[model samples]
Structures are given as C-alpha cells and as structure tokens.
Target: MMNRNFNRRKKFIFFLPVAVLIVAVLGYVVMFLWNWILPEVAHAGKLNYWQALGLLVLCRLLFGNFNKGGGHNGFRERARGMRAKWDSMNEEERAKFKEEYKRRCGGWGHHRNKE
Candidate 1:
C-alpha cells in the first residue's frame, strides 16, 4: 500500500511538470504562429513578446467587446462617439455634422426629433 501511494505521488509529480510544459509549449507555438502567419495590422504592431502583450492589453481597452452577437462593437463605439461629439456641437456645427454623417452613414448615427 505504501509503495503504491509512493508510485502514485511520483506519477503526480511527473504529470505536473509535463502539464506545465505542454501549456508552455502550446503558448509558444501559438505566439510563434501568430507572428508568422498573421499580418502586422492584425497584431497591432506587436512583433515581439512584450510588444504583443502590451498591444493586446491596449487594444482590448481601446476596443474590447463581444456584444450584439457580432464583432462590430468597435464600429458602434465609434458611431456613438461621433454622435456625442456632434450633439455637443453648436447648432451650425451640429447641422453640418448631421449632413456629413448622414451622407456617410445614412443618418443611422444621428438622433432625429419627431413632432
């Protein structure tokens, strides 16, 4: 019984390092493939390890959302920002912005008032 327990513990120790190695290797391969297979814009100027990590964090902050069942939330945020800036403008500027936004985005980004 003691021998069996010792063997089990030994196997557990071996398995622990193996599992960690597997994870590390997978991470390395994924990072390598990301750098090798993808373009620069996809990485957001993240060529090295630290750069990739930093860019990942910054990009997540600038545009990180999984909503509306699609990957277009960044565009939504841009639209919202444009709307808020337009609304904060003076009447003349707002009118001009409305025209431009309407021309560019079909007025879906601007708020319309109804009588």
Candidate 2:
C-alpha cells in the first residue's frame, strides 16, 4: 500500500510540470489568436500573455464548472446518493413512496389533471 501510494505521488509530481507547461502553451495560443483575430475583426485591444491567462481564468470562472463535485456542497453527489437509496428500496417501499408523492402532489401519467 505504501509503495502504491508513493508511486502515485511520484507520477503526480512528474506530471505536474507537464500540465503547467500545457496550460502555459494554451495561454500563449489564446494570446496569439486574440491578437490575430479580435483586434482586426472587432476593433478590440490587443492582449499580452498574462492578460490572456487572466482572460482564460475569467472565462473559466464565469462559464465553466471544474469543481469535481466540490462546489454546491456536492449536490450532484448527494443526488447520486439519493438515487442509490431509491434503487435499494424494496418493491413495497418504492410503491408506498410513489403513492405518497402522488397523494401529496399530483400523480404521473393519466392521473395528471387535463385542465
């Protein structure tokens, strides 16, 4: 177990620099593209490498979710857990739960109100 853990750590350490280098290359690509296209097409200001990196981060913050279920307090994970619980329920319990939901709210299928 210790050897396995150490091997994993060694791999991570080895890959970390490569990952950073990839990200830096991508940032430079972004800078190049923005400078190449946007300034001429949109009359936008040119961006330096650092500005491009900042733009990458800003776009990630605004439009991306990379939390691996960390944000929202693991809401997706909790949803999966609830699904597992439902799957583990016996037939009677499942039927009873469905009936209770239909009673309190509305039913599925034909039970729905036409109006």
Candidate 3:
C-alpha cells in the first residue's frame, strides 16, 4: 500500500504540469473558436471588439464570482463587515472573547491547560 501511494504521488508530480498546460491550451482553442463562430453566425450584426468586450463584461457580471452586490463580492463585503465587527468591539468584549478562546484552545500554542 505504501509503495502504491508513493507511485501515485510520483505520477501526480510528473503529470500535474502537463495537465495544466493541456487545460490552458484547450482554453485558448475554445476562445479562438468562439471568436470565429460569433462573426460567422451573426453576419448581419457583427459584434465589434468593444461590443464583445461589453458582452464579456456582462457575462462576467452575471456569472463571475467577483461582481458587486452578490456572489463573492457580497461574501467579501460580509467578511469585511465581520472583520469590522471584530475590530470595533470594545475592550471588554475583545477581552472576553480572548478569554473564551484561550480557555477553549488551551492557550494558542501551549499544550498544557492553565492550572
């Protein structure tokens, strides 16, 4: 079992870069294909570069994780708010949380319980 695990790790180490390169190449090919298809299929109303850029931005706005007001953006905003809550806590609350954390965690790096 150990030998098999070692061989699997070695195989992954050797193949991971190759897999990434293949994925990158495939993405470029797909992009080129999309560009080719768009102009050909919509000959009556060809989308210019800015139009394509706008579509890409819109798609990203709708589907991407970083768009504001939702998704990762909202997640990030919530995280920031949480952080602010932590930061804005009065000294008593901060001290209490520290006490609770220390009591639960047995003091960050120390193994022994406070006696």
Candidate 4:
C-alpha cells in the first residue's frame, strides 16, 4: 500500500511548478471568459493578466481550498472510520441501527410496507 504519510515536501518540489502553471492557465481562461462574455452581457469591465490572477486568487480564497492536500478537512478519514464501523456490524445490529436512525431522523415512508 502507498504510504499515507508520504514525504509532502518531496511531492511539493516535484509538483510546485506544474501546479503554478496550471493556476496560471486557469487564470488566463477566467480572464478570457470574463472578457469574452461578461462585458457585452453585463457591461462588466475587462481584466488584465494581473487582475485576472488576483481574481483567481480571491475566488480560491473565498470559495475554494488553499490548504495543502486540497483541504479534505478530515472528511475522507471520517468516512473511512464510518465505513469500517458499518462493515464490522452484524446484520441484526445493522438493522437495529438503521431503524433507530430512521426513527430519530423521521422516516420518509419507511414505516410503510414495501409491496
């Protein structure tokens, strides 16, 4: 299995420039799209390369993840834990848990018999 704690610094060294180029291309695309469509449609002003780059950074900061590992925020880890617990549960335990969850969450026609 691949090491989960692989050397991040080494990976960054290999991928940093590629990542930068990708971001630059994305910024250019944003600038092109905005210039192409927005001005005529919404009377928006045009953006220079620097402005586009700034906008890209701003959007990333506002709506995207700037953190390392793309900001998974422990979701993958939590999911793995949940999956493991679910897999370990026996059929009866699983059924009981499911019914309890439905009861707590308000069953949506789950109380009705299936035809």
Candidate 5:
C-alpha cells in the first residue's frame, strides 16, 4: 500500500507539469485567435493572456466535460435502457405507451386540419 501510494504520487507529480503546460498552450492559442480575429470581425475587444485563460476555463465549465473518457456515453446508456424496456414490453403495452406519449406530447409535429 505504501509503495502504491508513492507510485501514485510520483505519477501525479510528473503529470501535473505536463497538464499545466498543455492548458497554458491552449490559453495562448485562445488569446491569439481572439486577438487576431474577433477584434476585426466581431468588433470585440482584445483579450489579454489571463482573460483568455479565464475565458477558456469558463467555457470548459459551461459547455465542456472534464471526463477522461468523454463521449455520449450517458445518452447511449439511457437509450440502451429505453431499448431494453421497449423490447420487454408486450404489443398491447407498447401501443398503450405510444398512445399515452402521443396524448402527452401531441404526436410528432403533424398538424391536423380541422374542417
């Protein structure tokens, strides 16, 4: 256990600098792009390095995931669960479910012309 902890600490120490460097590079890229393009095209003010870095962090928090193995896994899992439930449903149950869904959601955007 001691050895394992030491190894983990060593790895973290080694990778921390790399991670920081990568984030710094990304921040510089963001700063460069915003300074080069947005000031001219969007009439936006130029961002300094720190502001660009903060913006990068803000965007990540708002719209990005920090997961290492990121993908649509959550959506896929939900879809898989729904598929399993649908497969297990009988025809009558499925029809009833569809009717309930249609009743709740007003069908699939098709409009009926009432004469």
Candidate 6:
C-alpha cells in the first residue's frame, strides 16, 4: 500500500506540470487567435492571457463535457446497453418494436424513391 501510494504520488507530480503546461499553451493559442483574427474581422477587442484562459473556461462550462475520459465512454456504454436489450428481445417483440418505430418515425428512408 505504501508503494502504491508512492507510485500514485509520483505519477501525480509528473503529470501535474504537463497538464499545467498544456493548459497554458492552450490559453496562449486562444489569445493569439483572438488577437489575430477578431480584431480585424469582428472588431472585437484583444484578450490578455488570463482573459483568454477565462474565455476557455467559460466556453467549456457552457458547451463542453468535463468527463475525465473525454466524454465518449458514456455513449459507448449506452450503445452497449441498447445492443444488449436488442439481443434479448424475441423475434415477435423485435418486429413489434420495428413497426412501432416506423409508425412513429415515418419509416427509415421515407424520402427515397421506391425504384
């Protein structure tokens, strides 16, 4: 347990600086792009490094996922659950489901030509 804790601490110490560097680089990139592009095209004011970082945080809070695994695992898990449910359905149940889905959704390829 002590060794495991030491390893964890070492990994955290190593990764913390890398993570900070990455965030700092992203902030600089945001600042550069905003300063370079928006001033001429959008007549927007320039952002300092801290403002750029804040904007990044704001955008993330508004429209981004904060999941540690980058937010796709939840989708995969849901898809897996759906597939399992589908596989567990009997033929009659599956047919009924398909019919109901078609009725509700107007059927797939509803706009396609029959020919």
Predictions in order: lDDT: 0.68, 0.87, 0.70, 0.85, 0.87, 0.88
The reply for model 1, stretches above 4 Å from the true place, is 40-115
Tens digits of lDDT, candidate 3, 1-115: 9999999999999899997676566555545656778668876355445555556557667877433554554677789998999999999999998888777778557785657
* Higher-scoring candidate on lDDT, 1 or 4: 4
Residue 56, model 1: Cα distance from true site in angstroms: 13
Best by lDDT: 6
lDDT of 5 by residue, 1-115 (tens): 9999999999999999999998999899999999999999999999999999999878877766656645445887799999999999999999999977766667577764433
Q: Which candidate should be chosen as best, given TM-score against the real structure?
A: 5
Runs in model 3 lying further than 4 Å from the true structure: 43-115
* True-structure lDDT of candidate 1: 0.68
Task: Rank all candidate structures by their TM-score, best first, as comma-separated numbers.
Answer: 5, 6, 2, 4, 1, 3
Instruction: In angstroms, give how far residue 73 of model 3 lies from its true place.
Output: 34
Model 6, 1-115: lDDT tens digits are 9999999999999999999998999999999999999999999999999999999899877766555756464788899999999999999999999977766767566853332
Is candidate 5 or 6 superior in lDDT? 6
> Model 2's lDDT to the true fold?
0.87
Clashes of each: 0, 0, 0, 0, 0, 0
The TM-scores of all predictions, comma-separated, are: 0.36, 0.56, 0.34, 0.49, 0.75, 0.63
Model 2 weakest lDDT span, ten residues long: 65-74
lDDT at residue 106 of model 6 (Cα atoms): 71
Per-model root-mean-square deviation over C-alphas: 13.3, 7.4, 16.4, 8.5, 4.1, 6.1
- Predicted candidate 2 versus true structure: per-residue lDDT over 4-110, tens digit per residue: 99999999999999989988998999999999999999999999999999998887777664456423666787999989999999999999999887766784554
- Candidate 6 C-alpha error for residue 85, in Å: 5.2
lDDT of 4 at 76: 88
lDDT of 5 at 94: 100
lDDT of model 4, residue 45: 99
